[model samples]
Target: MRRLPPLNALKAFEAAARHQSFTAAAHELNVTQTAVSQLVKSLEERLGVALFERRGNQLSLSPRGMGYLPAVSDAFDRIAAATAILDETDARQITLGCGPTFAMRWLIPRLPDFQRAHPECEVRLSTTLAVRELQSQSPLPDGVDAAVRLYDPSKPEPGLMADPLFTADLFPVCAPGLAARLKTMADLARETLLEVRHAPGEWRDWLSAAGLGSMVPSSSLSFDFHAFALQAALDGAGVALARRPFVTDDLKAGRLIAPFALSLPKGGAWCLLYRPEAAGGSAFLKLRDWLIGAAMPPTA
Candidate 1:
């Protein structure tokens, strides 16, 4: 027979450890902060170990807690995944998580084609921060069926499976009006550089590739995401670095221009990521194949 702490206590402990705050975990679990605290205390007493360290206002995991979390989280995830397979209410609707810009500029537009191909399936998108992969210790969030993002194969994540969808090549893109001024790479010094806040080093990488290692833009503007940065460029605010999937339509429509032939490969592929369990589902497979097909370049 297996011995276990109270399921409610385990839930409280997991949520508190993840957020590092009783109040935040309470908000998520829809319980009082006092209740969460008591449950965690009970769990610690049951285990005969201190799961968390209370340092004034900051709460952190103890060494035992740090080591204990992954197994606990994975157990809950397995239960949730098993439960999800039994849920038929939304069987045809699959939730896909990705960055907002990729959803807006790339995925959403092509979704219509997928719908045309398989009208029975519904693709719902949940936008996440521009991260390369899910946090190492965290499971795929409860509601997310799958996710797609840039994945560096060099850093292999054990539980998740990744399938390459697109080779994201980065290059400078700006409105046609700004493009004319950027006739030569040296002329970049005359223009404002639009940058995404999370990827501050992109401009430096592109400049080094162009052999203008020390060059700086006349001025610079920063946005929280690539979508905003690209929008600023579209309004002639500045030149923003872009990947092919995000700019293909605009570049073809003459709304944007890639002034230089030099494009830097991201040293990674934008890949579809999911747990091993979801691989066999027909709905998941359809979406995966459609995404892969949509990302392919046109054939002559």
Candidate 2:
């Protein structure tokens, strides 16, 4: 119906042009540098014009690109603004893409507090098998509003705002009943250790980081999800490496106990991810700030 090229190609060109570097645009997009170049090239081909002139390491906007920038940027901005106004409602909704174990242990218990504080808003959660990027309703997806991810602050998502919460420390744990019998991390080689299937190399990575690289076990008893592994540990079947928030309740009820003082992979912190388009929305801002504070460590 219109003379414009594909939206994806246009978006890629816009980001690349704005930054003046495909590498920077690719980093912002969470995609490959080659992908950004391909998208921009596709856009140029569709338009039958060159958007950027590459000179060694630098990228210069062509005459056509300079003229097209304002219109393209303005169009996306207008759509974003319109969506915010249309989606605004008396009842606010915050949907989080949560992991299975986190949903079971940390999130559900604290939700009552969130409801009490923001009764005007309706808070919901989505527990997907594959993380949010692969989910139907991701952080930037329609109706999702926002999502929580293990993100690094120094690294930013180009079009999305990344608000980091607290960090999670990964440590090994087991049922309290087996605590007195199993004394050291080395003892696990003889016994069954509950392995999380998704993080297949986690055990190896943890052991290596802990300076126990030479102490590889025969094999671990694996489970598809953290919940299943936690359940297996609770049954006194084996020891499991528990991540904070995910294992908070288990430790609280004396259901599980940490076996070693050495912790590995200490920076898997949770973050709130949302498109910059929703940054100005009063509801989205409130939810984003609330969640970041909500996940603050109880130890603090």
Candidate 3:
């Protein structure tokens, strides 16, 4: 027989520890703050150790709590995974979480191939601007099975498995008419420079890579999302820095042209991330293999 605290107490403790706030944990668990506090206190008394240090309004994990968190979290994750396997409702469906930009410009375009290959497995995509949230959330929000993120592989997050998809290569791209005007690097000064608000450094990186760092544009336009910036560029608003994978179809269709030969490789690469246990599941493995195979270069 296994000795364990009440499941509610464990859950309350875990939620409080993760957020470091009883109020936030209550919000997450959909219970009263006082209830969360009582549950955590009950858990602490049962364990015979202080799990958190209360400093006035601030809450932080005690040394014992720090040591206990990973084990507790992993146990919960395992329970969730086991339950998922036993639950027949989700057996044929795989939930994928990804950035809105990637979903719109890259993943959605290639989804048909995946559907064709696995007609039995339904790929349910969820888009969010907060990619980190997808990885950090406990109980894996809305039963998300996996995530595709543009993140640095060298600096991986704990408790998640990451598989590299592709490195991003950025170059300036615009409509065909705009391309005709950009004969030289210095010619960028005559046009409006388009920028994605979230990735303003990409333009600077591309300029530095092309050795045109001194060139300044006459005007500039900024958009909150890459898709918006790319659309503005397609409308001849200005030249936008394009990630190759996102703009491949546009370039091939002659809707967007890369006038400069120079391209800058971004510091991060696109990758698939998921819990370690999920990696072994047949549905996830199929999707992972398909994604990696799709990223491979075609044979001559």
Candidate 4:
């Protein structure tokens, strides 16, 4: 340690010099006025300098005190600035787990908005095919702060907080060129039906809702990923059964069109889930609120 007066004495001198009143400095530092006076006296005695001149209740910094104030204030400011830089370097990060399909088609597309709103927060996204894996891993793998998952509301996870993001709905969507030829549900049978192999029932449910339950397509193709099937539909290869939220942007952009008005609601919904303790911090709360706000309808 270098030779210097005690930190408390230095603080007392600085506060007293700035305010020019021992009572005011005491109020600001949450100490007794006598304590401020004594600390300043000790500092002046240790430095062999007259730091203040007192007359009755009035107090003024001496010539030496006036010169010392600027250096002391500058040092404190530099210390604070350095601490802030370290805080930002060690800033808290939140990891969100989501399904690969939803991550690509929904979450990823909207993430930039969240980033812009919270530049101080760092977000790491982890995508997986098994949504259940988000909860199944002991101690939560990959430091996942929270998860967006599809779950049956009737059988929600015990003791975990679940907030509905959006429900799933199935409807037939095809490229604009292909959609122009589809005037009715009957026309669906004439186009190649692109199916998501994992969710085979979606097409059947959508067909039943469209009044084409027993109708069989002339040709069909299947893909392991919904993204793949959707891409195929976008490319005019075939008509794909689109899920709500995932297909919302495409429909809005006119890249895909639902020729018929029928839509089938699925049994499960997409939900945001996290442990109770995980929701305590400001960073996580900001992300949670942003997600909820994004899910809501826009004002007129």
Against the hidden true structure, what lDDT does model 2 obtain?
0.75
Candidate 1 residue spans exceeding 4 A from truth: 1-83, 86-90, 129-139
Candidate 1 local lDDT, 107-133, one digit each (tens): 888888899999988788888534533
Candidate 3 lDDT? 0.84
Which segments of candidate 4 are over 4 A away from where they belong? 1-91, 129-142
- How well is each residue in 125-176 modelled by candidate 4, as lDDT tens digits? 8875344553466323435667887766677565467778888777788999
TM-score each candidate.
0.71, 0.68, 0.72, 0.65
Query: What does each candidate score in C-alpha RMSD?
Result: 8.9, 11.7, 7.9, 17.1
What would the TM-score be for candidate 1 when compared with the true structure? 0.71
**Global lDDT of each candidate:** 0.87, 0.75, 0.84, 0.81
Model 3, residue 231: C-alpha shift (Å): 1.1
Can you write out model 2's per-residue Cα lDDT over 1-300, one digit (the tens) per residue? 767688888778878888989999899888899999999998888888999999999898999999998889988876866475457672265566666677776778878887787778777777762464444444455556566656666767566777767566678888887776766667767777789777787777778877777885755789877888888889998888878777777787888988788777556467777766666566666677777777776674
Better of 2 and 3 by TM-score: 3
Which is superior by TM-score, 2 or 4? 2
Of models 1 and 3, which has the larger lDDT? 1
Of 1 and 2, which scores higher on lDDT? 1
Tens digits of lDDT, candidate 3, 43-145: 9999999999999999999999999999999899898886775455566678888878788887899999988998877888887534555346532344678
Best-to-worst order by TM-score is 3, 1, 2, 4
